[model samples]
Target: MLDDTLRPAPPRRGGWAAPAALVSVTLAAIAGFLFLMMVTGGLLRWSPLPPGSPADTSGRVSLPAEVGAPGIWTPDAMAHPIPAAAVLISGNTWYADDSEFYGGLVGAGADDYRVLDNEGAAGMASVLSPDGRRLASGDGILDIAAGRRTPYPRAWTDREIAAQAWSPDGTRLVVTSRPVDDEPYAAPESLALLDTGIGAITELEGSSPGLDGWTAAFSPDGARLAYPAGGRIRILTLASGAMLDIPTPGGAMPAGKGAWTRDGQGLLTVAGEHCDTCGDYPVSWTVTTLSASTGAIAGPQYRLDGVYAVRVLGWWPSGRPVAVAYAPAPGTPATLFDDPGTQAGLSGLTTVGTVRVLELTPGSDHAELAAAATESIDVADDVLAAGTLRDGRRPLTSVDRLATGVAWFVGLTAAAALLTGAYAVAQRASRRRSPGMSTGIADSV
Candidate 1:
């Protein structure tokens, strides 16, 4: 009879070959996908999705007068002018311990959309000049109409710079400077005024140590600067560098970046009543005005309800308060205030559901929606041109969709690689245990 061992080893059914092939295929597919995305992104000006019509078809883009003279902005014709009232929208990608943000400029009056390629993080708090021609951020200065950038002066290379606000004439920027190695949430070491025209910096007194996340604002006339520090609002006169400390109510702080009343007399700030012992979350929020000249409360404080938090961005031209409001998502715990230890701030509030830019009128509790987003949204404090409200929600742009797809692809590829490796290991172990099987078959044959 034919030896049973001489059955050709039954063709060695299911070795590592299948798994190895699968691993190779998965790697190749991932590589191809990344390459395709890169090429497509480059060709489409990094914006694969359509950005509605252009706001200005003058076909002539010019640098801000402060940066450069009027002329053709850049060789690339795709760069267009951004409107003054445009609000920045960010879509966030969260990892296990960190997150990345990406988005662009969008306006309510016109469908003017400009994608911010490299300034996704900095652009969130960037301030536009009163004239709406220049945009300033921690990175540098950008010509809103020309799509050009000017780097910060070389003297600032050793320090971290955070642009707080711009002077009324658009020639100067109020910025805070801290050592590069300092914790991001720590208060700034110094505050200075940067002359965008000459690239000069003038340091100011009364730096707020141990208090971070407070934004500074220039009075409407540009004579004084209002900022929160030491649990009070400090007004600094630019000419004499004299400071006035305006005490805030108990358990109250400057809401978002504080804004000056249109008449340049009072300061508008949001105050949150929180019971730290009970929970870090605020129980209620209010939009209150304080006298810029004195520390006393100016007008009646308006209670803002139905929202988790409200940040006073700036005042609309119509004398109404413009703000960005946050609401907790369903199933989100009430204790989910943003961890102050991390740079995530509002963007890291994973439980936040809806974000809306609203125009808060004094008498009515209902806010007029200027723009809305699912993740996060920010508007330049001084750039609410015409104070127009769109009353619409932001749609998912192409960048957001692409980011989501890439994230999924990476996750699946990693999982597949791990499984393939495990299978190969198991197959090798089985072969090692039965080392004599192949030899016996060959001898019988």
Candidate 2:
């Protein structure tokens, strides 16, 4: 009998290398395919939506980078007291875009609430005067402090104020209303407060204006009134009808759905300055006292949330209400953020300052992106980098660099696969050339 080794080893010559090559080819193909997918992957590519379809991992969903730590309310050099972005704040007043809900806006000055939908537009507004004089709305913009209704460029008249509540002293009432306007919803005719007290409501020729404003309030002394315009926060004095332009503490810009503070010295309005809106986030908070007379900002307060929703009691016997505050981060020293519109529009930033945090894009890893967020969803590197918001930093993923990395990996993998095939073929040829080779070549030459 022939020795086991010499028994013309049938075509049992196939080894693990053959299967191994197949795996390498599969792997090389997979690597190349994955790289392509990484570049052109995700729902955003084909959905026609904007590039960064915000998933909002940083506690803000209204607009990108809008919300901050909601529980922080104490005022200080570093307090994240404002609730950034828009919220449905339910209280004595309940508001709905449909007007079906029963409520008002004067309670919290939430009248500035804007839906984070296809547009920054608001549906209506519930306006109040400073001295508890007027409450109303219309296809026009209501100058809150002035207690005057100015016809809006757009005409939205169906919006209505669902409820109305007065401040402790009855000087102001929180009216539930939407503040922006659009197509059939022009004029922000959402909700409003028609001050039975204001002298100007008589100017609208009576009738309270625009679904007649809703839920109004008064300051502790009943001297000041608060309410919302489009994105404007208005504070008026009953005796003078003097309108005070209040600046939202952080990045929050009033849209409506707000009210007067306990002191009735300030007005509270839902505010937003999402990284999407601001396009960048400041590293610190800006505290400025604005002129109730001219919409001009003044004095510096402190740096809290880079962006947040703020409440202001217009005029206080003890001056502005000083909220006790603190920062969420331990090592990040607080610095005043900037508000450029502080003077020009009573809409700019103030108390400007800077922050330095890592950057991230909207489409980053599902788990890692949120972990990378510094404060809220509105917190962008550009928004939080420089104090003055001068195109601070870039958030894009650097597609070119990513592409280079993938190319390198694919090339290396292909080379390794080719080398394996060459080696395998050589080994088989060597065995066939040896006088001891018994396996016949499947494809003969």
Candidate 3:
């Protein structure tokens, strides 16, 4: 027999050994990376969804410059001891998109923020109860303190439901429902009041053909509801089942949603001015106070300038007007408000810029910033009305950024390796099937 050491290694029966080894190594590397991330994340106390903690009572927190560097942020103090909460969306690399983001109560310097468990809860239109104990969404009610979710009753399960506004007493919710298969932009098929206590449903009349803006507001005392319908503000008295329609001025339309003044004497609606020459962008916006009794103009009509857009959230307990101020982000298009109709519609633009919760001071153009985020930030109407917002700060950590980069690298490497392995398998099989053919060149060791 020829020297055993020189015998050409049995011509390597299977070409899968190299690929198999590569796959095994890739798996081991992935597991090791995961373990390292876990350890580092724990040591850093950083997570996309952090657990709840007691309210921060150490006073207003002044955030560092990094807090404004495109990530989820929270305030360190509240102007007053009220249950104010907000939904914070991350602007970081990993959670930049609509599907991947963080959402929950912002805690408003009270308790540590809590993340919602429901899918797409981050983007859903949600409102806090008057007492701030519960949050209502299309899925159902979430008890904040108890951490429990109660789905809607069977009677309303067939239709797609969205929480519009909660009664001042928190006993009832104004909800809009549409057929499950209906187009998202299509008007709601019906509007109704759902009793939170007994799970009862009372459908409202004249809500068909639906409301134009898909948003409604309860008066301060919760006696009436105001919504935009058929190009006019429609006020419905809950007890009498009577309806009142207030027409908007020419060339002006309801902007997103409206809020009832603290005194309940007027309804606050954003009047978006249309300009044919201005292209798709709005010429200007004005927070018009319409009379509750008549369609006539009521109180101060503040012309909101120096901002891209504004949404009338509600009034603070101090009677100061509060709203969301949207400032154009770097690459924001001029057609930002081309479809200024509903809260859900406008929410799609949060990624277009920075959102600031502002308390518009009466008799002054200066607006005090309550809270802000680099991306989207939505506070509950009740929270804005009942609680006080103060300036506070928190810094963003590097752990999340590092983790995101590492995750991307690992994913790409594994994918490339797997593809290479598959190609090798295919080549080996082709060679085995064509065993009768021979190449002029011999295989090298």
| Tens digits of per-residue lDDT for model 1, 1-445 | 3453522344556566575758757785875676576445531133233334556433222111111001111112125555443554444432111223333454424434555533323223455555555666666777766777888999888877766667777778877777778754534678778888899888764575312223577787888887766777788888898989898766454544447787888887665544444233444567778887776889757665555566666676666777767676655444312224532344234656656667776643756554344445556544464454443333333334445566677667767777777777787788778644353423343
Model 1 residue 123 CA deviation (Å) reads 7.5
Which wins on TM-score, candidate 1 or candidate 2?
1
Off by over 4 Å in 3: 1-102, 108-111, 118-124, 184-186, 205-214, 251-258, 274-283, 306-308, 328-344, 349-351, 361-364, 381-387, 395-445
* Residue 312 accuracy (lDDT) in model 3: 65
For model 3, where is the 10-residue window of minimal lDDT? 61-70
Task: Give the least accurate 10-residue stretch of model 2, judged by summed lDDT.
Answer: 70-79
RMSD (Å) per prediction:
10.8, 16.3, 11.6
TM-score of 1: 0.64
Checking candidate 3 for backbone clashes, the offending pairs are: 55-110, 61-393, 63-393
- Model 3, 58-177: lDDT tens per residue? 533211111232223332222122243443333323232322233445554443444443322222245666555677776688776566678988987787776667888889887777
Estimate the TM-score of every prediction: 0.64, 0.32, 0.64
Question: Model 2 off-target regions past 4 Å?
Answer: 1-13, 27-38, 41-117, 121-234, 237-262, 266-285, 289-300, 304-445
Query: What lDDT would each prediction earn against the true structure?
Result: 0.56, 0.31, 0.56
